[model samples]
Target: MVEKHTPSFIRKGSGKKKADTTEQFEKAVSRLAEGKYVLRLYVAGMTPNSARAIANLKKICEEHLAGRYDLNVIDVYRKPTLAKGEQIIAAPTLIKKLPLPMRKLIGDMSDEGKVLIGLDIRTR
Candidate 1:
Protein backbone atom coordinates (compact mmCIF):
# COMPACT_ATOMS: atom_id res chain seq x y z
CA MET A 1 0.00 0.00 0.00
CA VAL A 2 1.20 3.51 -0.78
CA GLU A 3 0.68 6.44 1.61
CA LYS A 4 -0.67 9.67 0.25
CA HIS A 5 -0.55 13.13 1.75
CA THR A 6 -2.41 16.30 0.70
CA PRO A 7 -1.02 19.80 0.93
CA SER A 8 -2.37 21.89 3.78
CA PHE A 9 -3.99 24.40 1.43
CA ILE A 10 -5.60 21.57 -0.52
CA ARG A 11 -7.25 20.08 2.52
CA LYS A 12 -11.07 20.00 2.75
CA GLY A 13 -11.26 22.75 5.37
CA SER A 14 -9.19 25.06 3.14
CA GLY A 15 -12.38 26.12 1.43
CA LYS A 16 -13.16 28.19 4.51
CA LYS A 17 -9.99 30.20 3.92
CA LYS A 18 -11.08 30.96 0.37
CA ALA A 19 -14.49 32.04 1.61
CA ASP A 20 -12.93 34.29 4.24
CA THR A 21 -10.69 35.90 1.61
CA THR A 22 -13.65 36.54 -0.68
CA GLU A 23 -15.64 38.09 2.17
CA GLN A 24 -12.73 40.34 3.08
CA PHE A 25 -12.37 41.50 -0.52
CA GLU A 26 -16.05 42.32 -0.72
CA LYS A 27 -15.89 44.32 2.50
CA ALA A 28 -12.88 46.26 1.27
CA VAL A 29 -14.59 47.15 -2.01
CA SER A 30 -17.68 48.29 -0.13
CA ARG A 31 -15.63 50.51 2.17
CA LEU A 32 -13.85 52.11 -0.76
CA ALA A 33 -17.10 52.75 -2.57
CA GLU A 34 -18.54 54.64 0.41
CA GLY A 35 -15.39 56.24 1.84
CA LYS A 36 -14.68 59.97 1.83
CA TYR A 37 -11.56 61.20 0.07
CA VAL A 38 -9.18 63.80 1.47
CA LEU A 39 -6.91 65.45 -1.08
CA ARG A 40 -4.23 68.13 -1.04
CA LEU A 41 -2.67 69.81 -4.02
CA TYR A 42 0.67 71.56 -3.70
CA VAL A 43 1.43 74.15 -6.33
CA ALA A 44 4.06 76.77 -7.02
CA GLY A 45 2.04 80.01 -7.09
CA MET A 46 -0.46 80.46 -9.91
CA THR A 47 1.71 79.20 -12.72
CA PRO A 48 0.05 77.76 -15.80
CA ASN A 49 0.74 74.18 -14.83
CA SER A 50 -0.50 74.72 -11.31
CA ALA A 51 -3.64 76.40 -12.56
CA ARG A 52 -4.26 73.62 -15.00
CA ALA A 53 -3.76 70.98 -12.34
CA ILE A 54 -6.21 72.69 -10.04
CA ALA A 55 -8.81 72.96 -12.78
CA ASN A 56 -8.40 69.40 -13.91
CA LEU A 57 -8.54 68.01 -10.41
CA LYS A 58 -11.65 69.99 -9.56
CA LYS A 59 -13.39 68.77 -12.69
CA ILE A 60 -12.59 65.18 -11.91
CA CYS A 61 -13.67 65.53 -8.29
CA GLU A 62 -17.00 67.07 -9.23
CA GLU A 63 -17.63 64.38 -11.80
CA HIS A 64 -16.60 61.37 -9.74
CA LEU A 65 -16.10 62.18 -6.07
CA ALA A 66 -18.82 64.85 -6.03
CA GLY A 67 -19.82 65.45 -2.38
CA ARG A 68 -17.45 62.79 -1.05
CA TYR A 69 -14.18 64.65 -1.26
CA ASP A 70 -12.28 67.40 0.53
CA LEU A 71 -9.81 69.30 -1.62
CA ASN A 72 -7.14 71.63 -0.27
CA VAL A 73 -5.02 73.72 -2.59
CA ILE A 74 -1.69 74.89 -1.21
CA ASP A 75 0.60 77.38 -2.92
CA VAL A 76 4.18 76.46 -2.15
CA TYR A 77 5.32 80.04 -2.60
CA ARG A 78 2.99 81.06 0.19
CA LYS A 79 3.38 77.91 2.27
CA PRO A 80 6.81 76.44 1.84
CA THR A 81 6.68 74.75 5.22
CA LEU A 82 3.59 72.77 4.29
CA ALA A 83 5.23 71.68 1.05
CA LYS A 84 8.35 70.59 2.88
CA GLY A 85 6.30 68.61 5.40
CA GLU A 86 4.60 66.74 2.58
CA GLN A 87 7.96 66.25 0.81
CA ILE A 88 6.71 67.82 -2.38
CA ILE A 89 9.53 67.86 -4.92
CA ALA A 90 7.59 69.26 -7.86
CA ALA A 91 5.46 72.23 -8.72
CA PRO A 92 2.17 70.40 -9.25
CA THR A 93 1.67 67.54 -6.84
CA LEU A 94 -1.65 66.07 -5.79
CA ILE A 95 -1.84 63.90 -2.71
CA LYS A 96 -4.71 61.61 -1.92
CA LYS A 97 -4.65 61.52 1.86
CA LEU A 98 -7.78 59.58 2.73
CA PRO A 99 -9.52 56.33 1.82
CA LEU A 100 -6.33 54.63 3.01
CA PRO A 101 -3.11 53.84 1.14
CA MET A 102 -2.02 57.40 0.29
CA ARG A 103 -1.25 58.12 -3.38
CA LYS A 104 0.56 60.97 -5.08
CA LEU A 105 0.19 62.27 -8.62
CA ILE A 106 2.53 64.81 -10.21
CA GLY A 107 1.96 67.01 -13.25
CA ASP A 108 -0.79 69.19 -14.70
CA MET A 109 -3.36 66.39 -14.15
CA SER A 110 -4.57 66.79 -17.73
CA ASP A 111 -5.00 63.05 -18.26
CA GLU A 112 -8.36 62.16 -16.87
CA GLY A 113 -7.85 58.40 -16.97
CA LYS A 114 -4.52 58.60 -15.18
CA VAL A 115 -5.84 60.96 -12.54
CA LEU A 116 -8.91 58.79 -12.01
CA ILE A 117 -6.76 55.75 -11.54
CA GLY A 118 -4.37 57.58 -9.24
CA LEU A 119 -7.25 58.76 -7.10
CA ASP A 120 -8.75 55.23 -7.03
CA ILE A 121 -11.93 56.43 -8.70
CA ARG A 122 -13.68 53.62 -10.48
CA THR A 123 -15.25 54.51 -13.81
CA ARG A 124 -18.83 53.56 -14.49
Candidate 2:
Protein backbone atom coordinates (compact mmCIF):
# COMPACT_ATOMS: atom_id res chain seq x y z
CA MET A 1 0.00 0.00 0.00
CA VAL A 2 1.22 3.53 -0.76
CA GLU A 3 1.88 5.77 2.29
CA LYS A 4 -0.20 8.91 2.60
CA HIS A 5 1.50 12.28 3.13
CA THR A 6 0.39 15.89 3.68
CA PRO A 7 0.41 17.99 0.50
CA SER A 8 3.33 20.38 0.00
CA PHE A 9 0.94 23.31 -0.55
CA ILE A 10 -0.73 22.59 2.82
CA ARG A 11 2.34 23.75 4.75
CA LYS A 12 2.15 26.57 7.27
CA GLY A 13 1.55 30.09 5.88
CA SER A 14 0.41 28.63 2.57
CA GLY A 15 -2.48 31.15 2.41
CA LYS A 16 -4.95 28.32 1.81
CA LYS A 17 -7.23 29.67 4.53
CA LYS A 18 -9.93 32.03 3.33
CA ALA A 19 -8.94 35.69 3.62
CA ASP A 20 -11.30 37.79 5.67
CA THR A 21 -12.93 40.36 3.44
CA THR A 22 -14.04 43.67 4.89
CA GLU A 23 -17.62 42.46 5.33
CA GLN A 24 -16.61 39.10 6.79
CA PHE A 25 -14.12 40.67 9.20
CA GLU A 26 -16.65 43.29 10.23
CA LYS A 27 -19.29 40.68 10.93
CA ALA A 28 -16.82 38.66 12.96
CA VAL A 29 -15.76 41.77 14.83
CA SER A 30 -19.34 42.55 15.66
CA ARG A 31 -19.95 39.00 16.85
CA LEU A 32 -16.81 38.53 18.90
CA ALA A 33 -16.66 42.04 20.27
CA GLU A 34 -17.64 41.91 23.94
CA GLY A 35 -20.09 44.39 25.46
CA LYS A 36 -21.33 45.42 22.02
CA TYR A 37 -24.97 45.68 23.04
CA VAL A 38 -25.37 48.92 24.95
CA LEU A 39 -28.80 48.88 26.54
CA ARG A 40 -30.29 51.71 28.53
CA LEU A 41 -33.37 50.90 30.58
CA TYR A 42 -35.18 54.05 31.53
CA VAL A 43 -37.54 53.76 34.44
CA ALA A 44 -39.47 56.15 36.67
CA GLY A 45 -39.06 55.97 40.46
CA MET A 46 -39.61 52.73 42.36
CA THR A 47 -43.10 52.04 41.15
CA PRO A 48 -44.19 48.45 40.65
CA ASN A 49 -44.22 48.84 36.91
CA SER A 50 -40.74 50.31 36.91
CA ALA A 51 -39.48 47.56 39.16
CA ARG A 52 -41.05 44.89 36.98
CA ALA A 53 -39.58 46.38 33.85
CA ILE A 54 -36.13 46.46 35.38
CA ALA A 55 -36.41 42.86 36.48
CA ASN A 56 -37.62 41.65 33.10
CA LEU A 57 -35.00 43.55 31.16
CA LYS A 58 -32.28 42.33 33.47
CA LYS A 59 -33.36 38.74 33.09
CA ILE A 60 -33.57 38.97 29.33
CA CYS A 61 -30.17 40.62 29.02
CA GLU A 62 -28.57 38.09 31.30
CA GLU A 63 -30.19 35.18 29.50
CA HIS A 64 -29.69 36.23 25.88
CA LEU A 65 -26.73 38.66 25.81
CA ALA A 66 -24.86 37.83 28.96
CA GLY A 67 -21.28 39.09 28.89
CA ARG A 68 -22.03 40.77 25.58
CA TYR A 69 -24.05 43.72 26.81
CA ASP A 70 -23.85 46.75 29.10
CA LEU A 71 -27.17 47.47 30.78
CA ASN A 72 -27.58 50.91 32.32
CA VAL A 73 -30.59 51.14 34.59
CA ILE A 74 -31.54 54.77 34.67
CA ASP A 75 -34.22 55.91 37.07
CA VAL A 76 -35.54 58.95 35.32
CA TYR A 77 -37.05 60.23 38.55
CA ARG A 78 -33.69 60.24 40.20
CA LYS A 79 -31.87 61.50 37.15
CA PRO A 80 -34.14 63.50 34.91
CA THR A 81 -31.21 64.76 32.82
CA LEU A 82 -30.70 61.31 31.41
CA ALA A 83 -34.23 61.36 30.00
CA LYS A 84 -33.67 64.64 28.21
CA GLY A 85 -30.63 63.26 26.44
CA GLU A 86 -32.29 60.01 25.32
CA GLN A 87 -35.65 61.74 24.70
CA ILE A 88 -37.45 59.18 26.78
CA ILE A 89 -41.13 60.10 26.83
CA ALA A 90 -42.39 56.99 28.54
CA ALA A 91 -41.38 55.01 31.56
CA PRO A 92 -39.53 51.71 31.25
CA THR A 93 -38.10 52.36 27.81
CA LEU A 94 -35.27 50.17 26.63
CA ILE A 95 -32.87 51.43 23.99
CA LYS A 96 -30.38 49.28 22.11
CA LYS A 97 -27.71 51.64 20.91
CA LEU A 98 -25.10 49.34 19.46
CA PRO A 99 -25.16 46.43 16.97
CA LEU A 100 -26.78 48.76 14.42
CA PRO A 101 -30.39 49.68 13.71
CA MET A 102 -31.14 51.17 17.10
CA ARG A 103 -34.45 50.01 18.59
CA LYS A 104 -36.64 51.17 21.42
CA LEU A 105 -39.10 49.12 23.48
CA ILE A 106 -41.46 50.92 25.82
CA GLY A 107 -43.24 48.82 28.43
CA ASP A 108 -42.70 46.59 31.44
CA MET A 109 -40.72 44.31 29.09
CA SER A 110 -42.28 41.28 30.76
CA ASP A 111 -42.89 39.76 27.35
CA GLU A 112 -39.80 37.60 26.89
CA GLY A 113 -40.42 36.45 23.33
CA LYS A 114 -41.52 39.88 22.18
CA VAL A 115 -38.54 41.58 23.82
CA LEU A 116 -36.10 39.08 22.32
CA ILE A 117 -37.62 39.46 18.86
CA GLY A 118 -37.75 43.23 19.16
CA LEU A 119 -34.08 43.60 20.09
CA ASP A 120 -32.96 41.07 17.46
CA ILE A 121 -31.70 38.83 20.25
CA ARG A 122 -33.93 35.89 19.41
CA THR A 123 -32.06 32.91 17.95
CA ARG A 124 -33.50 30.79 15.17
TM-scores for the candidates? 0.70, 0.67
Worst 10 residues of 2 by lDDT: 1-10
On TM-score, the candidate that comes out on top is: 1
Clashing pairs in 1: none
RMSD of each: 19.1, 17.3
Give candidate 1's whole-model lDDT: 0.72
lDDT of 2 by residue, 4-90 (tens): 111111112212255669875575467547536766677777678877887787677777776677566666776677688889999
Clashes of each: 0, 0
For model 1, give the 10-residue run with minimal summed lDDT. 1-10
What's the true lDDT of residue 74 in model 2?
66
lDDT of 1 at 36: 67
Candidate 1: C-alpha RMSD after superposition: 19.1
